[model samples]
Target: MRYLVDLGWLRSGLSFSFGEYFDPENTAFGVMRVCNDDLVAGGKGFGPHPHSDMEIVTVVLRGQVKHEDNLGNAEVTKEGQVQRMSAGSGIIHAEYNASESEELQFLQLWFMPRARGGAPSYETSSYEPSQMVNHLLPVVSHTGSEQVASINQDLTIYLSRLERGNELSFHQEAGRRVFLFVIEGELEVSGHVMETRDTARIQNEPHLQLAAKEDTKYMLIDLP
Candidate 1:
């Protein structure tokens, strides 16, 4: 149901630079590929960059980031908001902290393109924190659920926050894989303790059970 990715395990080897956090794998997980949790210092940012055949979604947890693309799209997404960019065919974009003094923390997700070529598009929305309590709150989906914004891959992203002593379960499809990232507080997942920023990649299980040691925050990614 869920594998535990200890923060201590990943931070030991990973490095950071250019306002980027890299978590490369031999092969990205299913249709859902890259997941980078980044923290951008104020007044510093990422310049223009190129990407093609990928769906990039940015979810801010704190502070704000300004996004600008070659197609004349410019916007700023704050905490509680979701920004989706489809780099179909090809596109050049840049992201930086909008604030001059506050550090920005956010998650950048990349999904493999479902098809070869198409036009590019961008969409954004705000989600209330309460929506994630006791259950998964779909933030982005390939089919585009009502509250969840649309994307370009057959995957889903959900955010959940559980109060102290709360518990939750997640079920996986026959051949599906799941990734969980603990953002805050403590959790006992499958009997192991996971603290903030720890992640878990789980496969070969029908379901998972998570219990909150305190008010815990986390994300669940279901990849196709």
Candidate 2:
């Protein structure tokens, strides 16, 4: 997982095993695994890559990303858009910037699927920040009813674009884990001040409350 600190043509921060950073104990959080925050230089991006038995989700934070896959799904995902690709058996895909003069910033997440070896699939959607203001917008879920592509896990990704002075409260269930990733602005969680790209791994808590210190956009993973 990579999280960039500032806007730029190319930037990244890794949150898990990548390159020389390999901590076996810090590989994943529940079913949620890789979370990379990336900023791509215009006209540059990752080449074709292969993935298997994993759920790949991309959330565009700024600019646009061109996606092409073996499943014949090809499109440019703009800011506020989300794309999910299920590499059940296997799939090859590539991501590139959609503009020649503008940089692209995005978040890429990987989750462990409940079961393996099935046909791959792809889906995409968009969520405006205004719609998520001060509330949890249920984007990805195990069930497809929430408008996000269904994955093989009993979890949901809730996105919040909050305003200063507003708060978000959640009830934590037993045996469930919550992974919070701050995307923009600042938030106070469990006495910790989380800035952009900072994540909090929380579990065994009875309740949760996030107070926004500024207009904040973040993703909260409710995982079992």
Candidate 3:
């Protein structure tokens, strides 16, 4: 992981190359391109930017995020909310903290679309924090349900909170990949211990066993 601090107001822990940070050896994982854990000071954020053929997802972890886009979409997403934007052909958007005195923490992820040159679109969905207790709540998926944001990719993003001593299991089809990120607290994934902000990239593992060492909140992505 790489740490990024921008202008004293934005701090980020990046899992893949983004912005001015580039690592040829660690560029991307499957179709997933960027995973940035960002903490922005109140009233600060990125200005309007352009993107094309990218599946962008944002999960607000604390405070609120104000999103504005050239597609005439403007909204505020609070904690537990998920936002997805498909920059199919092209799109321009900006994100900022909604509060003037509160810090905002969120995870911004980018994925390569299955095919490019479609119409751009945006959507938001939310789940109650209680719904994730010891359960993997699907927040984003290609086949989206009412409570899940749809994206132009063959992947599903799940959020979960596990209490100490609680365990969870996942099984995937053969030849698929798994990406795990610890958002808070600690967990023992398979056999490796992961603390806050640690990530695990797995392939050829059809089954995974996770146990919480402490009360933990995490995000897991099943990628093709």
Model number with the top TM-score: 3
RMSD (Å) of each candidate, 1 decimal: 4.9, 2.4, 1.0
What lDDT is reached at residue 50 by model 1? 91
TM-score of each: 0.87, 0.92, 0.97
Question: Per model, how many backbone clashes are there?
Answer: 1, 8, 0
Model 1 lDDT tens row, 68-162: 99999999999889999999999999998898888888887777878868798888877888989877888988888556789877788899998
In angstroms, how far off is 185's CA in candidate 1? 1.6
Compose the digit string of candidate 3's lDDT tens values, residues 1-224: 56565667898988998778877988889999999999999999999999999999999999999999999999999988999999999999999999999999999999999999989999999888899999999999999988899999999999999999999999977878899999999999889999999998999877799999999999999999
Model 2, residue 10: distance off in Å is 4.3
Question: What is the lDDT of every predicted structure here?
Answer: 0.79, 0.84, 0.93
Ten residues in a row with the worst lDDT in model 3? 1-10
Candidate 3 lDDT at 166 equals 100
For candidate 2, write residues 1-224 as lDDT tens digits: 34334435557776876545677877888888788788899998888999999988888889999999998999998877788898999999999999988888888888999889988988888666677889998878889654565767788888898899898898989999998899989999867899987888899987898999999989998998
Ranking by lDDT: 3, 2, 1
Kindly give the stretch of ten consecutive residues in candidate 2 with the minimal lDDT sum. Answer: 1-10
Clash count in backbone of candidate 2: 8
Error of 3 at 195 (Å): 0.2
**Alpha-carbon lDDT of model 1:** 0.79
